[model samples]
Target: MKKIILGSLFLCASTAYADRVDNVQTEGVLSSQITMTVADITCHINQGLGISQQIHIPTISTNDLRTGNTKSVEVPLMVDCQASNDQPGSIAIHLVPAGVSTVSGDHTITTSLDSVGLELAWKDTSLPALIIGNTEFTPAQATNNVWDLSLIARPVLLAGKNVTEGNYNASLAIKVTYY
Candidate 1:
């Protein structure tokens, strides 16, 4: 009788352990993926100079009028990204002008204006981050899932009466990253 009782107890313990192991093995695997896409990316400039000759903007048309410049021209840039299973995604835009130092990177514009005594300035007075919308995917904390971003750059030309007339050119680069 004693031997039978001991055998029964061992059998019950083994069955319980097997059931626990089986439950763990049946648990599903957890996994995720992330992806980003730029739905539409474009840029344009607006000039504020009053004199046509002083307003020879390059991003748009050569024939653009410079008369009655109200505010410096506004350049608009758009970017879009999407993620499948990722948490955060971010993008950085770099604008570099010809003859400017690449070391400065995205901090400043290096292109030289032909017009003498003409002052050029960026509209980002507050130096605020160019965020797409209020949707959150900012340069700091990028939003999860799909994000749409739009940014505008304003260029103001402070030209004197004796400003020179010529064509100015610059280049910009846009980069995106995900984690």
Candidate 2:
């Protein structure tokens, strides 16, 4: 019967499985511990990036002055980080440029002012500057596993363009990760 043929096939297959492993040898003792530890990473921000910031620009009348206009904005990225063994760990940050999320390798936002170019550069104020978006980089953990982060942003107009008179805006995202 068809039923008998199927049962014979199943029996043969199970017998073959045992024969396949006949030459296996027992290895040395294998052991490990699934240890658990506690770590604390905290971030504090009084205001989110959604809030529109009103920046005061003196004036934009002179062509020479407007072409060389540079503004600096200092912000705080207050954070507390603690890794295993109570030591500083490797950390990386990815800042999503204004008006982008799904795209990869995003950079600074394009200024709203017509026929004008704008660029932004940001870095940590510490001795060794950690310029965001420059290259693939990770920084050693701050002392005491805590960081009072002070970030500076420099927004400047790209050369060789006639400056325009208007207020421009941009928004960016900050993402921090540790390893």
Model 2: per-residue Cα lDDT over 79-132, one tens digit each: 454433443355555655555212221333444554333343334533322324
TM values, all candidates: 0.34, 0.49
lDDT of 1 by residue, 1-179 (tens): 87899999999999879857856756687888979665443222122221112224434222222443323344433332332333343444433333331212233332344321112232334343322212233444333333333233333333443333555443434333333
Error of 1 at 120 (Å): 10
lDDT of candidate 1? 0.37
lDDT of each: 0.37, 0.48
TM-score of 1: 0.34
Model 2: CA > 4 A from native: 1-40, 43-69, 82-88, 100-108, 115-118, 122-143
The C-alpha RMSD of each candidate to the native structure, in angstroms, is 19.8, 12.6
Identify the leading candidate in terms of lDDT.
2
